[model samples]
Target: MSATISPLAPKKYPKMPVIEGVRIATAEAGIKYRNRTDLLAMVFDPGTAVAGVFTKSKCPSAPVDYCRQNLSAGKARVLVVNSGTAKAFTGKKGRASTALTGEAAAKAAGCSESEVFLASTGVIGEPLDTNKFSHLLAGLVKDGKPDLWTEAAKAIMTTDTYPKVASQTVKLGDADVTINGIAKGAGMIAPDMATMLSFIATDAPIAAPVLQDLLSRGTAKTFNAVTVDSDTSTSDTLLFFATGKAGSRGAPKISDPKDARLGAFRR
Candidate 1:
């Protein structure tokens, strides 16, 4: 959303493919900025698997705690993300904001509160007003579509000069599957994990545990390898969602990260 793009940014953004069972919508809630989107809502079909890597900072954001607790469920129905005021170091108010936002997202997605994931970015220690955007969840869910990757990436950006996105298609067993990812980072570059926030979606039929293993391992070589500064942000978060819609196209279900059938997809 900045007037200038990063010199290291990709010359041209890739065309993001739509993954079945995944829908996204973005809104401008005026949480911190005006005339630009700052809220993102992503809905996943039931049974979608999820994995994540977050900041190692001891004082993490409230949304980080909310996600860590719900990750054990191994299922995801919705994701709500915001940029501007990170809900961190605000004690009870931070927790209240996450709970209220999660409840709103769950109601809109028709899923349990335990199935919703949340992430926030920007200035830390500021009390986030969940009401600023929580009320827009129902409308986002109703208007969401599967091809808004560009807008979704832009909505969650803070200091980043440009939206970062990547996509790849590979054969998962006998079926073809696609991976689409978007990331936001610039100033807080030394991610213990990248205020770096990233989200990836795939149509592969992989289980949550396997997705977790793959994501954890992948982060070590990618996000965790970059260092832009000595300080790490408390709001850093990365998440992946697998919708398993590829199963209908003959992709075999994978429950183990070491499965030889995923050889090509692993690379």
Candidate 2:
């Protein structure tokens, strides 16, 4: 972690609210930084829908490829992310690392490997040693809680001066829903696609297809429009997860992109 927070950092961080059906945990795996967190586990409820946008870079990271392959499943139960190694350009070793990590995460979260998403960012071309943190996943999942958004964001930081987080509450029909997001980036950012690493979660009951449509459109106008150094990283990823917990509160399950009740959320 950077010793100094960015000058452009928010003057006052917002109090992040817990999103129902999502619990997070962080661990100091000693992947790179010492005495600070470097791994994050986000455990989701069963049937949670997922969507994502990744970098346009042809040489993407191992986790990027792994995530793209699993995105077709649309359902997610766990997300395991780490900092300190992009795990790009390491050939078969990178692929093996992701596989090991995925299997461990799936076992820990009690989900299938296809439902476990992964992301990593940091030194490129260096092979990430999954052994460093894969053994810690079970404990992380067991201790996960919903109020760890800030810690979760910090665990994924590389060169980032501070953890990036934001939240919003909106009405989906007459039911209230909340959205929370976390991101990490300091340099080598550009609008090739997502530009940086970000993960968002919502309590809205939206289908994966609708979430994908919303994420794609939102990226074009937001993350894809931003630039820093005109350079993009091999691990640029933005993933969105909808846990559908709001359905119990009267929020409608929206599978159609044109659903009228999503007006507030769409805006």
Deviation (Å) of 244 in candidate 1: 0.2
> Across residues 154-266, which tens digit of lDDT does each residue of candidate 1 receive?
99988888888899999998899999999888876675656578999999999999999999988899988887776788888899999999999999999977899989888
lDDT values of the candidates?
Answer: 0.91, 0.93
Residues 73-117 of candidate 2: C-alpha lDDT, one tens digit per residue: 999999999999989999999999999999999999999999999
Q: What lDDT would candidate 2 get against the real structure?
A: 0.93
**Best-fitting candidate, scored by lDDT:** 2
Identify the runs in model 1 with alpha carbons over 4 angstroms from their true place: none
- Quote each prediction's TM-score: 0.98, 0.98
- Worst 10-residue lDDT window for candidate 1 reads 187-196
Per-residue error for 61 in candidate 2, Å, reads: 0.4
